[model samples]
Target: MTTAPAPPSLPAHQQPGAPVPLRAVGPPRLRALDGLRLLAALMVAAYHYGGRDGEISDAWGGSPTHQFPTASQFFAYGCLGVQIFFVISGFVICMSGWGRPLRAFFASRVSRLFPAYWAAVILVTAVFALPWVAYEAVSPTDALTNLTMLQMPLGVDRVLGVCWTLWAEMRFYALFALCVVLPGATRGRVVMFCAGWTLAAVVAEAANNSVLDIVLMPEYAPFFIGGIGFYLIHRYGPRDTTGWAIVAVSWLLGQHYAVTRLWHAADLPNAFSYRSSFGIIAVVTVGHLLVAAVALGKLRWANWRWLTVAGALTYPFYLIHEHLGWVTVHWLHVTLGLPAAATLPLTVTLMLALAWCLYRFIERPLTPRLKRSLMG
Candidate 1:
């Protein structure tokens, strides 16, 4: 007897008049990724406080000596958190955009990112800069740069003093948009684009030695590419084996970075390498391998609901806390004579509490409304 014919493949796009699927089949919720976001936020917070003493002084007003001698240096290396955020964003955005129209993808991104960003810029400039209006004049060029997310190239400071990453992310979005348009917006095209971007990032890292170069180079592309690669593997590969691998690898690399003093050199194997004269190809290859391993080993947990909330708040927290948290910590340390050791936990708690408030009252409410108005 002949077997019944298999069901026909779903159309790439639903017909104009046809009803769309109520529950579309796509990537599953990855709580581990949310947890990773939480971890990255914490790292960045710690990095700002523990490492960048100069920014801390400018934001707050005191200089507290390091009291925790055991792991102070290790904790000081918290700037790498931005790199983690970059990679994670790449993966999530790519996965979300896969199989979707380029216009829809771009619309969704603009809806999610722009509302909070604009609000933050306006809020910060109005509240923080107004009181010192005579002393602090907003430069037209800087204002334009910050508003258009082109401040990094123009050497303009972030509006809130902690919004540099927004520029990097906006640039990545532009590049990805270009990729979608030029290469047909297919899954394979996205993959190819990521691969090419990663290679370019490697070369850029190797060629540029200045701090500006590090901030503006192709080195970041690999992290984003690594993220996209993770998404693809999660989407099509064996869930059980691949998921376990990702969780394990990410944890290990995180731990290694946490404990070691090895600086990331452009010619090195680590993710944040800065030296440029060394072998570029080998370093990039190793960096990519490490990132791939970490992405493969990420693990989802049942207790990640809180982390998911934290992750949602991370962007705003990154914007606010880098300055506010340091200010708070410094005030407490100087005014109350609190030791530096006490500042870490207390500051983290306060930042988290403030971030939660912003997420609940401001960002969450505005985001959906903006999305509906802009994209729906």
Candidate 2:
């Protein structure tokens, strides 16, 4: 699931030679980003429901191509939503982390990530443990390890497949915290970090080094790097050439990596075979363009009041949607004799309701207390 805190106040742009300060009244909440995040989460849910591989198909008792047909063709590309999320993450992280101390930054991250995550791990584990559910449940030890969000490095399977993205976000946060936040995230330092990460990712891929690939995340580094660049442009002004250059280079590289990765996945026996690599490339391009538009302030009109609530549901919705949604689909469509049309909407409604409860009841009460404890 894509997750990050709200953007913090930002210092305004300075004269070319003047030093930039750390704090000032920043722009209004990018409700548009919240809206974009919700859309991304929905896209991912759509993919898992009808466009993924044999799991959803197995649950539904029919091939996705035969079952979803036209919709599957579109939803097949929804995995690209994660790319969109990474880009948003970079932008939000840079915005939030700017001018904050390392302790405050670290505290905010822990508070934001763990409240819902711990709950989701236990909840998804319990759901999978139901006797009627077909999805295999992980051992209690793995589930406990998952609570720390270190399961990826520890060689444990994720309780929810979407947790993998949370792991990626964690790694990005670590790199940012040490390299940027710990030292202080000034404009120059942030730009340098982005450039350095982009270069290292390239080297890691060229050398085929497993360790560097894991650390650098060549496939996803561009999106996060580009997001930092966008935040810089948003903070400094549109005339920031260095920021624009970083974004431009990142967009070019992001497309290449995305297409290459998707193409490689084409051979996977259990995964959805994409219809066209070119189509995948186009979708990735669109994802970059959308974030770029937000950076340029073109989407400011999308700042509707309800989007804040929409954003609140995104993370939890993503967390529970995969394993739990699939199981519900199996029970509803296959066992209950409901049609796909009715079953899909009903399942989504139920998931959204659960996400809201997770947010309103659990996240709302726990976040500030957790942050205060960590801060202390």
Models 1 onward score TM values of: 0.71, 0.93
Candidate 2 C-alpha lDDT tens digits along 179-259: 999998777788789989999999999999989988999999999998998887777767778889998999899988878
Cα lDDT of candidate 2 equals: 0.86
- Could you give candidate 1's per-residue lDDT for residues 1-376 as a string of tens digits? 9954433442322211123342344545666677667777787787677654465654335432244444544455556677678768877777676556666667788767766666666655654465532224356566656776667667776666666677678777777877754344454565557556655554666677565354434545555655665665554443434333433443343334323333454455523223222222333333444445444554533345765786787776777676566457656776677767776789888877766777777777887787677665
lDDT of each: 0.59, 0.86
How many Å off is the CA of 48 in candidate 1? 0.4
Q: What is the C-alpha RMSD of each candidate to the true structure, in Å?
A: 7.7, 5.9
Clashing pairs in 2: none
